[model samples]
Target: MIGRDAELAFLRRVAAEARAGRGGAAVVRREAGIGKSALLEQTARDASGMRVLRVTGLEAEAELPFAALHLLLRPARHLVDGLPWAQQAALRVAFGQGRDEAEDRFLVGLALLTLLSDLAEERPLLCLIDDAQWLDRASAEALGFAARRLGADRIAMILAARDGGNGAEPHLHGVPEVRLAGLARPDCEGLLATVAADLAPEARDRVIEEAEGNPLALIEFAGMLTPKQRAGHLVPLPLHPPQLPVVSRVERSLRDAIRLLPERTQRLLLIAAAEGTGNLDLVLRAAKESGAGLPDLEPAERGHMLRVADGRLRFRHPLVKTAAYREAPLVQRVAVHQAVARALDAEEDADRRAWHLSAAAVGPDEHTGDALAAAGDRARQRGSHASSATAYERAAQLTVSPHRRAARLAAAAEAALGAGQLRRARTAAHRGQRLTDDPPVLARLATVAAMADSELGRAAPAAHTLIDAATGVTASAPGDAAAMLATAADDAWFAGDAWFAGDHAALRRAANLLESLTPRADASLAPVIGTVRLVDGEPAVGLALMRAAVPADDRGAGTIVGTYAVFSALMTGDDDAACALAAARVDRCRERGLIGELPHALQLLTQALGCCSHAERAGSVGIPAHCGPAGRWAMTGVSVGVVRRSTRR
Candidate 1:
């Protein structure tokens, strides 16, 4: 608060606007100990007459899907029943309270927005998220989704995250940001004076310089000084090696403080750090198993290192928890993880228990691997694709059989692709391919890798990979081979479009490949085949096929087939058909809350409108503001630009 007046003022304005039903959000980003958390705390205190919800991300739970979001919304669980049934079911699945079934990730996010808006009906709500960089990918995405769509609602979200390190969070990229910098000279000197007023002039100046405007460092360095050092009778050693980063120096200081604590107190802190959820009962059970008890936590409390409140234990700073876990010996860390795993309720906390067991394993353990694989299945059921990828990756690492490992890696790659982690999907797929020679598994891996590559703009290579994969499986799994060929056609189209505006070489090659396969009576493949034919100079036949594939109902219009049909119509200059199909797709997306598909649908519709010469209608298209960066890009990018160009032509 000392040097953060301007930042605080901005947050105040956000809060004021939200209170007046013009909601907004801001992400506070900075290096460790730059007062991001403190700023949020100060803002919470200043927001009088508002309901406040706070959730801090824990490193130990970073791979657990929706963990932070579950914690943040625990107080509002009663409001879930008020949401639409689809939204209710999505929330229930995400929070692990309902039958295991896949739910759209964006639907879960919309459910969160609705629940929070309901809560804010009584009073303005301030949601503070600290250490957001450590939030699980699913939780971060869900939170970002809700934050971007709080329009006309009495809610203000402020997320604080560490930047410029391995912990950087890219999920919150599009939110308004307030970056904190090192304090100015006068502010640094003032802060140092408050913590080390009696220090000798030279030592005080040295402390200020060494602290480098970090408030935590200023207070901690001063606290570490001896009487002699303070009085100038003896020089204090440098706070840390000059080469160490500021965060490392602070963590080292915190570790030293932990070492000075009683052995039992250190063990208690370790248990708390390992548990991560701060569930005091779970911590106590784990501590009891580890030869520590509730009494041992008193020392840490008195030292202002952590606090126990409302049956939960919380560290004073995220770095304290990090230091407690990292400074411990590997054996001790493993033992704590095992103890925590044992303390978990076998039926209720199986996912967390499986993760802890995996963490505790020192070598290949098939049982642990199986447990993690099951955890991955549960994550996938909840549509937490990033968490599913992490669980499967860990499972693959612990499995002894190469085939099983390959299968797990394949699953990981698939989940990563669903999570939009293109590079991770490609890497996992490549690893899976290297492990297995089975044609089916190889084909699966190749398909995933090619899809990832196509999205990453390697369309030509992607098409080639898909073609080879389809050929390898053509005899045994004709259905899968045909599906791969269909995808290959799409990629080939992209390749041709990207390289030469009107070139048909890639499309011709793909068309020939598809024609060689025995065609099945699958309606889904019609548009894909039609697209190939259109680019292969058979416009009349292509347009007829594409027109036949167009859905007669709105429900089917929100599908991949519908997307391709729209594209084909556009290509063949059937403006009326293209606009109608595209409009239906957008309408279905909005009605069903299919936020993930809305951006693409909007883009296609905008292009269709342009082709139909409805420039005014295209300009006035109702693109959702909550559709994140993708929707914004669709509105401003080539989707709209190409439409304008076509109209001009």
Candidate 2:
């Protein structure tokens, strides 16, 4: 509020643009206590006259599917009846009101999109979600899906989260993001003066230096001192100054402030933190069981720890709720989790109940582990891979059997990979590797490692992983082994790694492995065979095989064979077909959100466009002539000499 004029102006303009029928989306991320909530509040104010909807994520409700979306759209529920019957039914199924036997997640996302578009038809819609990191996976993905597809719907979305917060949505990665930083020194000093006008020069210098220009730390530390201490008239106590970063100082302030409240009032805050949804009924139920009542909430209200609005309670800041839960005793935390778990109906909110049961567990419990695994399964079915990874990882921790724990950990790795969390996938894969050496387990781990490495641009390691996997499983799983070999050959050839293509040894090895597979009819085997044969000097046979492997319908298959097929077309002097294929591949990759495949598609499209002299359209793939794919792929003997531009960044 003090020094955010620039940010406020930008957000106001975005809102104005949305009101004028231009859809927009922005993600604001920063460290905790850096005033993300304050920025969000100002966004709501700037969106005046617009139909502003709000949803705040809660750590306790982080596992509840569609919980955040339901909260955000509850006020606009009447509009759902006007949507197409299919969309309305999809929403009902998503919210557990209808049959969920074969529910499609994309349909749920489409339903929410239509519902928002309908609302926008009446009035511009401004959706502000604070603490997006804690949004349930289904809700985060659905909201992100809608945000991406809005064209001219007069809708704007603003999301705020701490950097790397749990349950973060990847779909928002491409959205315009602003990282809020600490205030500058001059601005910090000016703000500090507003809160501590009587501070002496020496004391003020010490406080500012310790705060490191963090606005929240400056304000909290200034308030904790008396006027006399501020003016250097009284000696300060020997308490330690807050450590670096704004979040720690805020946490200390919140914890210290809560200690001033009565025992029952503090307990009430804890219960609310535990439930997270701000559902008054659920909180009251939990509070009653904990021997507290409605009167207990008054003290918190007076203390400004919470506010009641439309029969729900909201914490003053996102930090207060976090601090309350974090600072509670272990036994008390477990008891509250158990109480909330007991309150949620297992049939309706099984995922939440499972998560709460896991939270309440003090040690290994197979039943809780099984419940968590089931929750992970449900999350997977809903396309919430990241959430499924978390649930599976937790389930692994709770399982007593070594093999089952290893299997769960491996599953977590696979889910994390599917969610595009490469670091987590690597960690989970490594842990699983240490726990088991079974060939099948090793093969799965190797495949995960190879795919992650390939996405990260470490082609050699990826090829090595593929080769190892192929070697380990060739005897028992011939089809998988052949596929892995083909993948390795393509990666090596495209990456132009010296070991694979400098002398063609790697490609030969991969080809040899494929040949040993008894010449099966698997479509995947074609690209590698063709590429290896072509590179090794059998051009006619290679072109024939590659052409046959190219999928007629899937323009953006982005597979190893697909890349070679495009190259084959270009080599045959079919520049027009090649460009069209490349463009289609790019479009398909974007449509499916295949981020890992996008780079390849873009590179291929750039080459094709350059060869066709479509210079004006080169910007579409975000590449210049100097860095076209032709030169980049030339190291492996697949050069397009027609486009003789340097492929440099």
Candidate 3:
């Protein structure tokens, strides 16, 4: 397939080697619709005369009997069926039911393995099992036993499966595994032409992408598309059209498999699909929210999605979710989602909780709405405005009342303000104000609008907006009073109150009033606190305030320390202290790949310590022994400004 040529080649080589009795067997893996079967089929066709044995798996047949290994051993039945009936019956019972006659079954199974072993007396015997994800436990154990005993023998085996399934074959100790994926563009194009010849070259290319390099899906999806969607650009479509879903031949296999799931499992899958990927735990938790006991979901057999080595969980397939969700009645789907939203809301896992609540209610649930709002507030405090906006949007989805929806929208705008996404902020603010008639909220909007300007460094405009918010709104309102004071404090700090020679006394009064009026302490106030003290000629005070707001062991504390260290090095004469602080902050920054703070710290520290200064300080201490870019920049900055180390001049 597309990016799996290397894996296929390696598998074939291993199988051929085992067939030639030159080496041990091999193993391969891949995800759903990744051509695992196709590779095995190709291998089978290529080894037509090599005593090949094939076994296929089925969703319905998995629990019935020894269907899987029996399929693989079917070709050898010429020898198996001829065995003594009593022995055969004993073997059959053993094959299907593990506990019936352990010794007898084991002996019969051993006899069958002996038969296959003898069938390949001189020539190599190759066995291939497809849909190994659903391989029966009995069949799997038999294969494992056979595999274990076939070392250095003229036998090879290949088991193809959807890589991460509950029924996936157990790992083989010596046998290597190869995973399959989608087909190459040309292979896909060829397949497309064979299936649907009317597609123009451009349409053909687009079909290529719609399939996600999945050959089976590409062929199936092309059959259902209307002329309009399939007639254009060769680029990938972000969202599939409602009507033109996967209609390829291979897609039918997956569809049939999903049809067997119970209604509750189907509902569970659909809700999960709406939340997107890597959400198994969330989905399972939310699926239980229906208040319908596990008995109700008995038809929908649930299985834990194991974590892949790459650190992500996957549903058996996206198609399974699509079928399950699309098949769910709309009213039922919405009701279940609402329940899941409530459950997630009750829990404190903000990020995923926001997602579940958003999809579940889609209207209003007080608990879900409140939880989303809290999550949004938390995101803003952490300076992740993007996440804040997302949280606020989820809150909006849970807001049935227009007024509440408007408030949620406004909160999103507030988050956008800190992120400097002015256009987005303005859109949210406008929509919110239009929907709500609350005067206090209008006044708050004015204040937030003003803060937006201040953040962009337009201080004069910022002051005018602040005054408008403080006076234009009701003065007696406590929240407004506190907000206005906070705005005043921000303006005074930005205007450099400590350095303003003309109005030192007046500036201090405004700052003091704002500080006194500050209400409902939250992490959101941490940045503002640090900003004020840093500008008021109190770096130590600013650092202390930030530390108080962010716990010592928290991720945010490192960021606050970093900001203060940089500011101190830049505006004061504390090179050595700055160097040490910056070095620690840089390592933290690099570990998390934090932007904004790391570069600033580096630039500041670099200016305070030049190369000669470093050399002198390093007399024997030598570069802090654990330096980061901040230390290096400090060295460069000092060297350039003092010793003419660069050609900038």
Give the Cα lDDT of each candidate. Answer: 0.81, 0.75, 0.55
Q: What order do you get sorting by TM-score, best first?
A: 1, 2, 3
| Local accuracy of candidate 1 as per-residue lDDT tens digits, 131-249 | 89888888898888778777679999999988853222766878999998888878987887777789887777777777788888788777788788887656655478858877798
Model 1 per-residue lDDT at 42: 96
**Between candidates 1 and 3, which one is better according to TM-score?**
1
Assess candidate 3 and give its TM-score to the true structure: 0.40
User: Tens digit of lDDT per residue, candidate 3, span 451-516?
Assistant: 666666655455555554554443457445445644555465456434532223333444454455
The TM-score of predicted model 1 comes to 0.87
Which order, best to worst by lDDT? 1, 2, 3
Clashes of each: 0, 2, 20
Model 2 lDDT at residue 253: 74
Provide the RMSD of all predictions against the true structure, rounded to 1 decimal: 5.5, 7.7, 20.0
In angstroms, the error of model 3 at 435 is 6.5
